[model samples]
Target: MHRLFKNALGLRKCRAFAHDESGALIIFTLYILMAMIMIGGLAVDIMMAEERRARIQFTIDGATLSAADLQQTLEACDIMEGQFRSAGFANVHVNHTRNGAQYESCGVAEPDADIAVDVASVEGIGYRRVEAEASIRVPTLFMHWVGIDYMDLPVSGAAEERITDIEISLVVDVSGSMGNPSTSGETKIFELRKAAKEFFTAVVKNDPDDDSAITSVSIVPYYHTVHVGEDLLDQLNANGGTVSVQNPITNPPGLTSVQSEQQFSSCIEFTPNDFKSTAITPSQKLTRKAHFAYGSSSTRFPNYLQFECQEDRFDTRYAANSRPHIMVHRTEKSQLDAHIDTLTASGNTAIDVGMKWGVALLDPAIQPAVKTLADDTTIPVPSRVNDRPANYWVPSVSANPQDETLKVIVLMTDGVNTTQYGQTTENQYPYINFKNSPAPVWRFKNWSTHEGKRHDRWSVNRNMEWYDQYLIYVPGNSWSNRWYRPGDPNTSWDDQWYSTSEIPWDGIAQMDWVDLLDDFHVDYMAEFFWDEAERYYHSYYGWSTREDPMEDKLKASMITQTNWWQANTNLSEICAAARAKGILIYAIGFEVNTGEGPMRDCATEGDAYYFDVSGREISTAFAAIANHINQLRLVQ
Candidate 1:
């Protein structure tokens, strides 16, 4: 019985061992499954965190870009908040300071709320690099079931805002080609106008203070020629009539109506006092051959000339308040509006002409007179008066001369220089002719003929004695048997000949020869008459008589006729000339190949002065320039 009990105990122990082994196997399987679940959950939470971080980062990046482009603080904040909301951020807040620091806040669980946007500047470098960082809490998906509630996510982004003083010239191509339909189905001119207006608004926003600190954009509208507004044209009378008047006169020769029925129908009434006269002979009877009629003439007259003598008439007929010159140089909102309204886009693109006019307008030498306001004693003033006194503020001119003001010219051209016309002061000499003879002249000593020559045939040696003989020839003598004399030629003399070949020809070729003379003749009398007529015409009308250098020469030498050229040259020279002057030149060449020779010369070395941009990237270019100007620290 003891042996059987021991065996039973052993069997029981064996059963127990088997049960323990099976339980161990089950525990191992459960542990393995649990580990797998944990790992899979963690992975899902990581992915969610990554996606949230990516979304936040993208939003921040876009916000930064938008802020960099913002000219106003409110706009920057609005854009940043809008971008955050669009990116699915739960709650977004943005606060930015103009020309200062910016702070951003968002309700991100994992990210730290104390995120800072740090801006760093490198001395001598124009741009400031901005970096932002934030930590946000990302809600877990499956991991939340396993005691894990959220994931901590870190995100960061960087951007650069460059500050540069920009000197830009908006050179628009107002050529005939601009009138063609653009890719947008609108005329290029219309598109340009729209784009320009947008650009102008942007510029105004950037430099809103009117302190002239940020930028000054000079709009240069060029077609075949540049149109200098009538106001600017009035100041450049330096060369007299060398520069043709912008517009010219037009009038019919005869009166359209007669009051008296008794007046002879065939005879036109002559009223000297009532009639206007040309500078030439007054009231000359019009010959049938003379192209004169009473009706409107077809000859296109220049705009300047058209109203030259009619200014008084226009003033009388049109109310002075409604006239174009009512607000000549005032900064009142309506001034520019009225001026722009009067601008009619007609005529060819004269870029050079327009540029010249632009230069003249900006010339310090020709700056408009600044009004001196009488000081107000009633109001208290600051003890330490600012350099820019309130009374010294002018409507058209800048107040502070020391501020880093921007001067820009926008030059656009659809084609190259085709036709160039200008009034020059240089004189061109006319051609003259002269003739010469090959034979030499001689003179003889005085001697009287031997009294009718009765028998005085003393032929002593025909050759040797002839040298000793004394004979004189009269002025009208023929050279049959005449001797050579000292003063008067004993030999026959022919009339001195003058030819056209001897004359020197200089000056511009006339556009129409018929306008100067009817028929070409070598006749001296006709030539003399034409010369007098030309002199008189120039003296009265102010036409150019100088020869222009070849276009190639002008291009090669960089002697540009454009306002930018003159301004650049003036700036360079002025900088070199004055020790106190700190002149900055910024050049931006749009859509042009960077490797072009002209483009390369347009910019200076180092950071702020040079930028080459694609044609479409004007906004970025302007931003860079604005940032540069804002960063300038006034040196003591």
Candidate 2:
């Protein structure tokens, strides 16, 4: 009976153990711990995969960027594979697509399709874009339990390096105000030189890599006008022919000297029609800027030697130096920097003329002239720029679109447009007829030798020392009453008073209008004749009744060629035309005192292109522009 009771208690204990809820909690906890371990393993696997992907993405980004640079000498696939190997992915293989064409390789001689890479190109307005894409597989460490053995990591990169050829025109202002001090206490031109040199180096320098594309720059420095240079002048249709004029006080009496319109100047006169378009037609006749000084200080009596054009001058007091001429299609950094260093400031501001020349240089119309310049042995244009001043880009019509070029103009100024004086193309002046020949007026060699009395009176007396006197002849009238010495010393001076038709005028010498103006003041020339008329015809009573009409005629010949309003309008039009032709324009108003409207409108519409800077800020502006331009030549 005791053994049977022990067996029943054991059975009861087993049943109680099977139905116990307290132990069930411990079992559930065990299962939860197992799940947590498996989850943690999966998380570790995912983290490892992500790290690999991040590394791969970085490698691809760097690889593609280096490959896409136009300066890179290696093939895109080769560059990418080398980068991958450097990143410790030696066994990886890639299927490469270059500009929509595909090739498979493992960075080895054999083809392997495990990984993928692509490089493509897209055309931009003024640049060509290169895109690179790549993808790699990262082997999984723990997620393989879920039937996933690897995770795919895809990476992409794009770069553009001004693949198309580029041409830049740097238009700079050298106005008198630029000589004044800037906010930085230095002259505007001084600051400009520093900024411009830095900019030139930034654009022309190729750091650690060489580019396949061509990039050329032109420097157009202007004040009242532009000096297109002697070589380029030969290509243009400038009407600067030589004219023969008699020299004053020549012993031979009528000795003629050849006078060239370009003797003192080398500038062209642009008509309103020329400004209507950006085209510089070689066949069209361009008038030469007159070689005369109309400025108040220069027009002072006995000081007409100061010509309006500063081309022939070699003085630094006038400009930085005498080298104020355009330099076109150059690629050498040192050459451009040296050119920028020579810039000086003088003359009035003619922003319109500067802009016109700046745009013209970029236009294809100037290509013919550029070619001639390139062929020249002295100061030859760079061979790299042989095909430049290239045709205006018409993307649709381009035979090989990759051959397109970008045109750019950088216009900088310190002042607003001022009055630009020019000689009129009118024939209203009577002096025009005598410009190439001797006038009908003869001057005494020693008129001032006698006291003021003999100078005012006209007498012919051998006994009274008849020697230096002036004689005048009206077209329909006879010679004026004046004393003249015989050609022979033995002959009497009184014998010449015989008749008006038989006057002995060989003893005196006369000069052409051009020579006369160069030798004496216009007022003096006009007054001498008037005083002679009073002495010869006794017309002093009515002389005051008539004003000095000759002076009015002389002054009227020089009119305001380009006024403020016309200049502004022309500037706007050319800027618009340049934009329409797909040329990029950048304008900077450096310490501008007057309105900035013209300059602002001349630049490209975006704020990135136009800068209104003062003093040392000009350097910042130039740097910004250089960065903005050079930025396009790098990966996007």
Candidate 3:
């Protein structure tokens, strides 16, 4: 019975052992723990790879940015490589392609990973665009066991510095102050030339690889007034004056025939109303300013260089290339540079006039005149920029952004506005008897010892015998009966003569008032005529303002005077008008007083737009502005 019981127990035990699951549960736990470990490993590897990829992406972002900078002087790909080196990525390999060129790899033998960089740069007259793309192969750590080897981190960026379709009005002051030396011991004009030329080179870079240009610049050199060239006067249809003289000093003189005189001065007399707005109306009839100068006769007689109209100095009417006149939209660097070199400093400051012309060039109202000038050969305007001086940007209006223009004005001045002079509409001055038309002069010096006799008697008479000789006309009622006509008056010279016929002043060739004032100084002409009348006929004629003939003439000629205060008001108005139209203004006060406010108020509301520099700092200021325009910014 024990044996049988034992056998049953053993059988039961075997069955129990077969149903027990503790050891099997331990084995299953082992398998699950193994799988969990593998998964954990994978997660760790993926997270590490992601971190590495983020690092690579960060590096690439910096690299592409530096590479795409227009100011970056190094090769695009080279710049990218340097950026990587700077970022402590010396081991990472770089493969770069620029402008469709073949891919080139940096010498990184057996690098852990590779970064591919592609760059494309396009340069133009007023714009530069750079696009860069980068991708890094991040070798996976644990993921490779599962057939995943690497992850790609791609970063792309683009940068652009574009002032596309830009119109710039460079209103530079050529006032006499510009001739003074700056703190740097160089003439202000000399320094200005270098600075302005560099400014052009920076903004209007003519890339040798690209012939396209969308930038145009108009040069308006101003002094007391803006001198519109001869062509501009004709375009404006500004009319000149005519002078006529009747039989003068006669009993009830008769009116003589009138003759039209050419407009010698190219300056316009803008009324007080003209400064309230920025438009230079093409259809409006502009009165041509009379040519005259005001100063003492001693300092301004023969030279006549200080005339209100600078036509005598520049002679732009005769010389097409003469400067101090407006030079319309120019593109060529050579042409612009040459024009700047010709700038001469003379005349008082008239900041308002300068700003007026500067703003006018950018105004759309002046398009007709600009178009006409663009077709003209002397203007140096390129055909490609024929549609320049584009309309001001209005964001509310619907249009493509690329078509919008950026108008910039760089107004530079050294001094505040001074007294400006203009002429009257009426011919209130005396007619000048030119030297070409000689009048008869009779002189009778009586030596009391001898009988009453006339000496040194001379006049202008026609003589066929001796080319041309002076002859005195002695009328029948004179002390000596001498009928002198078409012959020399020397036949009656006996060192003794008497006063005879009154000088025939009616036969003299009368000069037009405009022509006379332009050719001769006001005080000089006044003195000449007054002295002639007093010395010859013992009489006086013409308008007298101060009882002094010279002073009267000077006052009559300079009828219009724009004081410094009025000019400042006009400048401020024009500047505000320009800014309201979204036109950018950059004003420079070179070697000017600190208290000056008009120039400061004219600039766009920022220090970057206004430069009150002196000496060589002017160049630094100009360079800053140029750089601001060419400053790089990420587009994407």
| Tens digits of per-residue lDDT for model 1, 249-299 | 111111122221111011111122212211111122311111111111222
* Per-prediction TM-score to the true structure, in the order listed: 0.35, 0.68, 0.64
Model 2, span 318-433: residue lDDT tens:
34334467888888888888888878777787888888888888888878778877776775686556566888878788864345776888999988988787766544443443
Query: What's the lDDT of the predicted structure labeled candidate 2?
Result: 0.66
- Which segments of model 2 are wrong by more than 4 Å? 1-63, 71-94, 97-130, 134-157, 205-212, 240-263, 296-304, 313-323, 378-387, 399-402, 430-478, 482-553, 632-636
Candidate order by lDDT, decreasing, is 2, 3, 1
Whichever of 1 and 2 has more TM-score, that candidate is 2
Error of 1 at 556 (Å): 23
- Candidate 1 vs candidate 2, lDDT winner: 2
Better of 2 and 3 by TM-score: 2
Winner on lDDT (2 vs 3): 2
Among the numbered candidates, top TM-score falls to: 2
Best by lDDT: 2
What are the lDDT figures for the candidates, one per model?
A: 0.34, 0.66, 0.65
